[model samples]
Target: MPTQDTVQRLYDSMDFQRAVQCYLWAIPIVGMESARQTLIDNAGARSGDLVLVTGYRDVSVMMGSNVTTPYVFAHFDLTDRPLVFEYPKGATAGSLIDWWDRPLTDVGAPAPDKGEGAVFVLVGPGQKVPDDLPAGARVLRSRTQRALLFTRGLDPDPEKVRAVFETAKIYPVGQTPDGGRTRLLRFKAEGRLTSMEHPHGFAYWQRLASALKGESVEDRDRFFAAMLQPLGLEFGKSFEPDARQRKILEKAAVVGEATAKAGAFRKRVPDMRYRDDSHWEYLIPQSYSNEQDVPGGTMFEERTAFFYEITGTSAAVLSKEPGSGSAYLAAYYDKTGAAFDGGKTYRLRVPSGVPAKLFWSVTLYETDTRGLIQNEQQIVDRTSRQDLKKNADGSIDIVMGPKAPEGLEQNWIPTRPGKSWFTYFRLFGPLEPYFERSWSLPDIEPQTS
Candidate 1:
């Protein structure tokens, strides 16, 4: 009954709405794609080689990563044959996540192997299981053909970290990676921009379309997948968006990413605030499950918010043991409820008796790339391991500004002017006080002359 003009307007609005929804739904997988591509493009990694990402400069290639340990990772294509991933026993832990960012399994201490070393046969969607599998090796399945293996050694010793890295092995199911059958592809710092956050513009859609080809349509994603077909993302087909679809998607990319930023940084979800008196919140941004799943369904909005800020998750990263896994707290705003301004000065108070069994660190990151903020001074973090100036009560007052504070240069992390920053407080092996909420951290406050 509607006129032609009314019909056209309705279609236009539908196209716009679908575009934004696509961005929200695809945020997690797109993040995984961006990371793999960055490893290939910027970190000099190929499909079958492991890339060791260590040190502050090279770790900057990640999105909201921890610098306390060295991470060695690789992307594998399981479409052809199931791959065998062998990990050595030591102070190492990791995870295997598919292109959708759903963790297939935790790989180290929290795993069935219990860090005593283990082998896994990784099978992908539509891939046939091999009959002659390695004895006692567990089989992990994925919904997509592409997956990444990220393992890190928890020891503080640099030489030990390197030694552990050399023990990993990855080979096709029919072969054994014995006697140097495979080698690790170490990442050397090039001081270039190797951001792993989701890409902007048409690159986002292009990556999403490619990822969908190898994915199995989940029951929940079926309707969303149909919506994408009209927006020029057809599984198994080359991406070719028409002029109209391109225009709609381009605008959606801007609005969708902008919306993601707001939801992630200024979370308003239930139980998002870490403490009643502080602006610092859980880095994962949800209390139900750090992995964002509940009894019946997933926390959709909460998952979207977190994947926009960081990629990959596992039981080890969210371990509930008293002195075992990691705990992360993030502060996106200052005490005045304002986003941090790099041009201004601020100070964070680390109280005495911090609740970390192993070590604790406070690292500042640029919001845009979610990487360590690059400064002329080449400093981005302050840790309990470092010999920083301690207060009379054994506390640490870490300062941040364009210029170092007089007499406090050792504890100051320089920030670049004309930028915004946030900080992550990581507790490696969080202790009882952290779980009991007995040790509450103070918020970062603006310094007044």
Candidate 2:
């Protein structure tokens, strides 16, 4: 026996709730759509084309990448035929992920192929995999035809990277031996941006629709498929949003971007924190799966956070074997628990007992864009591989601010005065000390001269 006004109010409340739910659900979809579009754009929308994306020079803010290792990227369409990926003996680490960002298999060193690489024959849904394969080749079956293959070089030396890059080959099965050679496309250091950002307005929905049409939907993703129905986004259908739908989607995109940003900076997972008082935290879990402490299950928030923070994945980030994979820790605040301000100088000291089997590095990034902070030096990071001056105690000091401290130019990472920034400390081939917490990193302390 409610009045008309009460009934109207109840309906409005339901509508508002639905809008909020839709916004949250769209976050991951937007992420997937952005990544898919990036791959497509880089590959020239052509399937089975490989692009060698990384330079001999150190990665800078130009590409928004901080990776020290040279990288290779490729887009694959396996609907009609299987694709073959051959790796060189010295290939380091990489992964093949589906359009939904679900990793199918690890490639190179961390994989069964090890450093002495092997051929990976990728077969998609309904594609016939040849029974007579090479003796040592591994078969990788993917649920979707649309896949991304990313591989990294072990050494950053220009000559070493070129040597490794020359060995990777991709081609459709049954193609001639000469046709199996991949087209090498080097990344341009100028004006390149690899990080995926949230799409503007209803274009996000358009990209989602295009991705859905290009890729197969998994059973686990059926729920999201159903959710998109209300917004007129369906597989194999045109995503022509109506006026009202466009408005809703536009608002939803804004909210989705905010949610992703919050999740990246203020993650709620307990295992993310490396130390109680420090801003540094483990960016990825030891397990490849997103489950916090468990073996399986999707940690949706954690996955979203990671995609928003960085691109690409590898078994190297998840392997349990010490010195086999790698580990990453990121910090946003100084020792006093204050957000890092580019106007103020800070110093981070790596103690003598740093734990890294291969090497370690600290790279700075703009807080908002997650890109390397632009500086006069054009360099984004300092690594153990570099011949750096060390203190008497065997420790190393890295200074950060607008200007270098006295004669510490070699150890300084410049930060723009008006912006905020963060740093990621990477342990390539991390050892037991890092996992067991026996080795600890000192907090970034503010330096007032």
Candidate 3:
């Protein structure tokens, strides 16, 4: 028989352990919830509305964002019926992802149409796919009704992008607008929107509850939904946290944020490391979605780490078909294993054999925001499309610092002196060399002079 004091101490210990477990588990759920909210808020996205983002000057922090390609965003609600999505013949690439950021299917150039353009009939869960589909139309099935349709206009010309966007259309299958005309809602600038910012305190739980309304959970994710029930976030129920519960959740959100941040900077999986001794790592590898083949079905830690680092999803990152996809590598630290400091200058050397079939680019992003770093020049990156001077050995030495190197303004990427930053090396239409590891990228070396 234990004394009253001993019993009280045991209870306290159990409570502390439970709090820690909840904190860690909440990180990934919060990340996914945040992304869903971001799409809804920034895109003004609603069921059955296709929002076309055509302006080149538009700025965003969403993952895999490229200034070179104009974007189109849409959220589909398939609870009532299936929707017909049609695209022009000139789109560069496109994807349809679920609320949890899993790729449903690829469209546009990566699809069977091969850039000639085609119509996609999106069918939601439990919905029967139409057998009598229109000629040349492809039927794609999604496990969830809430889906994100993202497309990129490949042309660099602003006028050409706008023209292509006009050709895209979304409408109900049998309820096409009068005269068979497709309606488009253009995206208007609504100032700088922070869609990825994590909601703090009780608001975090509230947001999750709101997002879960009428949303279907995958069988693999049912366990997560069960875990949230104890915290008053059960599906189809009111999420009203009491005073004490709110305090616990407040601390949990803070701890969860720190854990996610640490995981993003460090390699959580073996494939994430680019080289044994190098600081660079592959942002999205070919094996990223292969976790299910293993005994665990999926590696939760690796998935959390990825969503915490960036947003957006596409089969292009995982597909093996040539000219059908892209690749991304990120580096948070310098060669010396020190966090990148904006005050110091660094130079990255690209060897003679760059492995991109379409184009390659190195874009700088702020460490805190994970968005393109804002500088006086408004230029956040340099690409193969730019006229860059080559080294004697055919390599390119790109300089990055507060000030441009002498006579190298064209190759310099400016950074703010007081901020920390990182870079993403993007390979549009990655080729054989990138996969074979024959083409290697050097680490960012510090420049004291």
lDDT of 2 by residue, 1-449 (tens): 99999987775454434544555555544555565555555445356655555642324422236657776667777877887777667856788876656677777778876778778788888777796665577788877667787677777665676677677777777764486456665544455555455555566666666666756566656676666666667776788867655666677767776776788888776678787766788877433373222445556667677777675666557776788787889887789888899898999998876788888999988877676777777767888988777999999999988887887788888888889988889888888988887778989999988
> What is the C-alpha local distance difference test score of each model?
0.83, 0.70, 0.71
Worst 10 residues of 2 by lDDT: 55-64
Best by TM-score: 1
- Spell out the clash pairs found in candidate 1: none
Give all candidate RMSDs, comma-separated: 1.9, 3.2, 3.1
Candidate 2 Cα lDDT to native: 0.70
Clashing pairs in 3: none
For each predicted model, how many residue pairs clash, with residues at least 3 apart or on different chains? 0, 0, 0
TM-score of each: 0.95, 0.88, 0.88
By the lDDT metric, which is better: model 2 or model 3?
Answer: 3
Give me candidate 2's TM-score against the actual structure. Answer: 0.88
Model 1: ten consecutive residues of lowest lDDT = 284-293
Error of 2 at 382 (Å): 1.2
